[model samples]
Target: MKAELEQLKIEAFQLLNRAQDSSAVDALEIDLLGRRGKLSTLLARIPELPVEERSGIGTLASSIRKELQDAIVAKRGQFSAPTSQSLDFDPTWPGHSPSIGHLHPVTAFLERSADFFASLGYTIADGPEVETATNNFDRLNIPANHPARDLWDTYYLNPARAGLLLRTHTSPVQVRYMDSHKPPVYIISPGRVYRHEATDASHDTNFTQLEGLAIDRDLHLTDLLGTLEAFLKHTFGKVKVQVRPSFFPFVEPGVELHMSCLLCGGKGCSACKQTGWLEMLGAGMVHPTVLKNMHVDPAKFSGFAFGIGVERMTMLLHGIPDVRLLLSGDQRFLEQFHY
Candidate 1:
């Protein structure tokens, strides 16, 4: 029994040294130390051995198990050590360049328009695109059964709530500003507006509008026309302008301002539909009823208001044919305006 134990110890040591990896070492451990293994078998046979020899044999088996465990841990570290060469970066190589972004055409136009107004002593004002019916319609002198309400063609956020709608124009900002501030107000509201309508080459259901409002002791229709003329001349560089009578519910004695078609230089052309003129903006004296609604005394504080389509101005300025292209997000269409 002593000779058999010595032979098993030598064989186990040889197997442990031959193990090339942690997995092989684990298999060897199971073979020698498992419940049905050689070590376990020897331990199980202790009762068959003389009682004096059992203690010494058990001690030897435990010593062998400890040695095998230590060898496995040491071999695992050596097997996992990285053998590949380290990389060194070359400082002389050119680095990658990150892309730089520019403003979109619509955004560029808005900035330019804001700058133009700011130069005229008109501070920029803003309002919520999601607005109530009173601000969007009623406060602007648009009554429930009025035809002007149909013209707004608004996008309602919630119909059952009676008046929550996406604003049809930035004119609502004028009402809000009046409600909050006293007269001698000079503000240009520039923002996105929504409508429910079929899109065409010239029209978009969603577009931008810049509405200007100026209320003081003695504002008039002439002051409104003069301001628009100055803006158009500054914007288009010495362009010709003409105003024709028009109608709007919020403004009394409204007129549609027209500039000679930039594309054809006032000569008949396809851009102006052969009329030699392009309607640009709508301007008029602030209606008494509109002021009365906002608690402003129209008799003491008369004013003028105008609304211009930002997309139209951009198209006229850049000679863009389709309004849809402005909002389409097409890379090819946008790349042309890169500056």
Candidate 2:
């Protein structure tokens, strides 16, 4: 019986060493130490043996059971240890490419355009999207019954409020800035503007506009023209600019600034409507009415103001066929600008 017990100890040790994983080790433990297992059976049969022999065999069995339990625990530790590295993720394996994002084309253009102005000592100014008719139109010399007001085609928030309307342009920012700051003010107001216009290939109900105002002593139209020409060159990179007679109620003499078709290099093209020029922005000296409304003496301080459509600028720069694409939020259209 003693020899059999010794052999069982050797067999248990061999089986424990052969267990490939924790599950196999658990199975072996149940086979050797469970209620119907050899160690349990031996412990149960002890009462039938002589007292002296029973004590010796029971002690040996208890020691062997303890040894087997320790071995199983140690083997489980070994099994678990290797799993972390065994199911090893190859360090060199290609990982999933993370989705990257970028600024919208309009936004990129806005930043670049803003930086260009900033470099020339122009600071940024902003105003509310919801504005009073007085600021949006009246102060700019568009009277209540003036036909020029029709050109804006405004979106009024409350007709009863009479003058409260969504701003049609960022020119209101110019008025607001001048109202707060004295002359020698150079500012570019870049923001979203709302209109009630029907959407088309060239128009959008919601768009962005950048309005620039420079007020100081002795500023003239030539200064305006030269500044605009430098800005256009910086923006479009070596392009011809043309200023034609135009009128806006806010200015005594306003002009439409145009840049040569960048796509066709000034040659006629569909993009330029075969004219070889694209109307870029509008500029004029600050109207007396506008200056008077802001309490700035128009005679003492002459200044120029210009408004440029950011969407149009972005569209021309990126060769986008439709202006609507700027606000479409379509991934396919936008992904092309990803850095």
Candidate 3:
């Protein structure tokens, strides 16, 4: 038994010295020192020997086990020792550059439209998103119970004190502007509006509107045409414009303005429904009743007003197929509009 113990001690030391890596060291430790190991098996036989022999063999076995454990630990540490003389890192490698951002397409378009009108001597006007029912409807000549009111179906706010609701259109700003300022009033109102309508590819319950009003003595439809023509040219880059007769409660002889189909170039296409023109906005001479309601004498002062859907124009100009994308916060869709 003593001879076997001596043989094991020599074998274990040789294996531990030859161990080249951490895994090899681990195997050596398990085989030499673990439970059920060769040394343990040999030691277990000691209890069966003569009672006088047990103490000597047991002491030798314990001494051999401790020596092998120390050697195994030393082997593991050797593998983990640092290979370098000092700590260091390469300084020449390039670093990451952060991304740059620009305005959203809708906001960019709004600013350009405002700047264009400002250049034409039209001061920008603004009004509250929550407004009295009178300025939103009646003052614009759309009185309650009037059939024309049916056309502007909107979300009426709850707790209807002061008949307040989210402004259905920016036209209310023009009414507010006219009430305070006298003619020759030249102003454009650009703002967000709310409607109680269902959303589809082209419509949203919440969207933006830009309305323009120009009031002065002897203003005619021709002046409206010329100003809009220059604006269309400036905006869409030399597109043809057409005005067809339509009706609105606020504008007598109201006209729906159309721009040449950018996709088909006025030759007829699905986008324009074979008409070669896309309806852009509604405009006309201000109704005399609206003028008189605002305290502008219709006999002396005449004007023109137009309301444009800013999102509709942005979608058209940018070839954005869905109106919801303007409001969608998806980074991939919005990244395409970044400058």
Per-model TM-score, in order, reads 0.70, 0.73, 0.70
Better of 2 and 3 by TM-score: 2
- Give the TM-score (vs. native) of candidate 2: 0.73
The lDDT ranking, best first, is 2, 3, 1
What is the lDDT, from 0 to 100, of the residue 170 in candidate 1? 95
Better of 1 and 2 by TM-score: 2
lDDT scores in order:
0.84, 0.86, 0.86
Candidates sorted on TM-score, descending: 2, 3, 1
- Worst 10-residue lDDT window for candidate 2 reads 81-90
What is candidate 3's lDDT per residue for 1-339, written digit by digit as tens? 989999999988988888989999988887877898899889889878999988999999989988988888777978986546422444676676898888988888889988999999999999999988899999988989899777778877776475888888898898888778988989999899998887876678989988999999999999888888887777899777788999888999799998877766688765466777778888999999999988889999899999888887887798776789889898898898875
Model 3 clash pairs are none
Deviating ranges (above 4 Å) for candidate 1: 1-96, 266-274
lDDT, candidate 2, 127-163, per-residue tens: 9999998899888889899998888996888678887
- lDDT, residue 166, candidate 2: 90
- Residue 89 CA error for candidate 2 (Å)? 8.8
lDDT of 1 at 214: 93
